[model samples]
Target: MGAMNTKVIEAEYDYVKPASLDEALDILAEKENVKIYAGGTDLLVKLKMGADLGMDIMMDINGIEDLYGVDKTADGGLRIGAAEKIWNLETNADVIAMYPILSEAMHLMASVSVRNMATIGGNFCNASPVADTVGPCMCYGACVELKSKKGVRTVDATEFFLKPGVTVMEADEILTAIILPAPEENTGAAFTKMARVRPDIAKVSISCVIKRDGDAIKDCRMAMGSVAPKPLFLGDISAELAGKKMSAALIEETAQKVHDFVKPIGDHGTTAEYRKEMAHLIAKEILEKAWENSGGELA
Candidate 1:
């Protein structure tokens, strides 16, 4: 499917570049069989494969200045605009310092060239189960802002994706921004992935965020990707680990919980059983790294 498809993208669709969110929403509200064009990294590939053959209206919202940058919310969280490039997130000093897990995920995603052309919002809207950003975003307590002709609503990352290549987004909705809560003073986060290769889809990936109070885990959150239908958040497992002293035994128990909780599908890169196993391993590893970063020692 790579280069064999010779379809030209512009041949079938009427294009519109809306300069304002109001104009875009008006178009979306009025149009049927329309597709929102962001970075087009995944959209273009899907188009070439004829996945969206019936799509006749291509609404290019990239020109909307309101959806274009990362800013700080008054509540000490990050508001990442929908059209901000992946390359920007990877190299942005504020993003790197405050949200290193997001930076790590971005670094491990597609290639540098693809990242240059991909947007954070496009990645989420593409809704691939193995989307590298979703895992870390979930762990970081992120939410997405969706807008339509009606109004704007915020949805947590955990509740955003309905299934593979699907989301809670309505046909007329556009994801305007992603909001990430600032990490607490004692919190630390880490992300790890077991992919077939650097630039390929992850076989299994996990992100962990933990807050420590002296020697105990004060709070914890974990999210895993590519091992299930969508990125799975292990809130139960996180709760079990919280308030407990960090140790190899506790880590193993939590890892086992993760292994028991997920039901992964088998694919070329790994078997279902192997995916579950790696989920355990990577969960433990990332949790430990997060603990250590929060000033715990591996004893």
Candidate 2:
């Protein structure tokens, strides 16, 4: 519910804007209840709602030079600095050209103004069930790089979020970058979102990346959001469909399976039943689109 109808933050915390990643990590290692602040889109709202975060330090990593770059990785994959704003990704020529699915997802995000302030890392770290970008990230076979003074480790994007308002990242670990594997040749991807309003929080969303093998499905990654505590990566569904020939019957059957697998709650701007059904419908739509985009006609 609404904590109060106020615009002021009720919590007490020290704000730290570090100029480098090492400086940021050092602050985190020494502090407790260190909330990594970015964009301040969601965090500020919660604080204004009078949520007691028990905050000790608000570490702003935007000033950190190492946490702000977009470059191609060694394997031709893309490495996106965690602090990149969502709006920038939407307009990045390389990102738009190479991963149109992500571009589409970005466009469907909040209004242009909010997107300007929201960082990509902040969105994932926020760990909202209705987060629009998480499913697309998982579908692209992405990983999140986490760094602490102890060392650095990578967590698969699909595995990062443990629950709402929680991630596998420790209090001291910082999300350094998002590593996205290069899309295989002849592969196509698709994304769809359902919300009460355009550019609003998603009620239900799905994304898929498909590598086509002639008329058969060579491989695929599928995921959905707003239907679970964390984004649901359909590894089982993808495994089951891999190597299977594409057909209307197969798509219809998979949709039924999706509806059965999802466990959405009846809240967040829609009914559980509605989200469940939309998940099924979206799966079918994206399956066909991705297949067609990969230069094959769905039979």
Best model per TM-score: 2
lDDT, candidate 2, at 52:
80
lDDT of 2 by residue, 1-299 (tens): 45486666767888888888888889889878888888999988988888888888888877688888889999988999999999999899878877888889989998999999998898888999878878889988999999999999999998898888888989889998999988788898999998878967888899998898988999988999889988889899888989999888988898888889999998845898898889889989988888888887866
Total residue pair clashes for candidate 1: 0
- In model 2, the runs with Cα more than 4 Å from the true position are 1-3
What does the lDDT come to for candidate 2? Answer: 0.87
Q: Model 1, residue 188: what's the lDDT?
A: 88
lDDT of 1 by residue, 1-102 (tens): 344554575347898999899999999999898888888998888787666447888888787998988888888888999899999998998789888989
Q: In model 1, which range of ten residues has the least summed lDDT?
A: 1-10
TM-score of each: 0.95, 0.97
Q: For residue 281, give model 2's deviation from the true position in Å.
A: 1.2
Q: What local lDDT score does residue 147 receive in model 1, on the 0 to 100 scale?
A: 98
Model 2: residue 66 alpha-carbon error in angstroms:
0.6
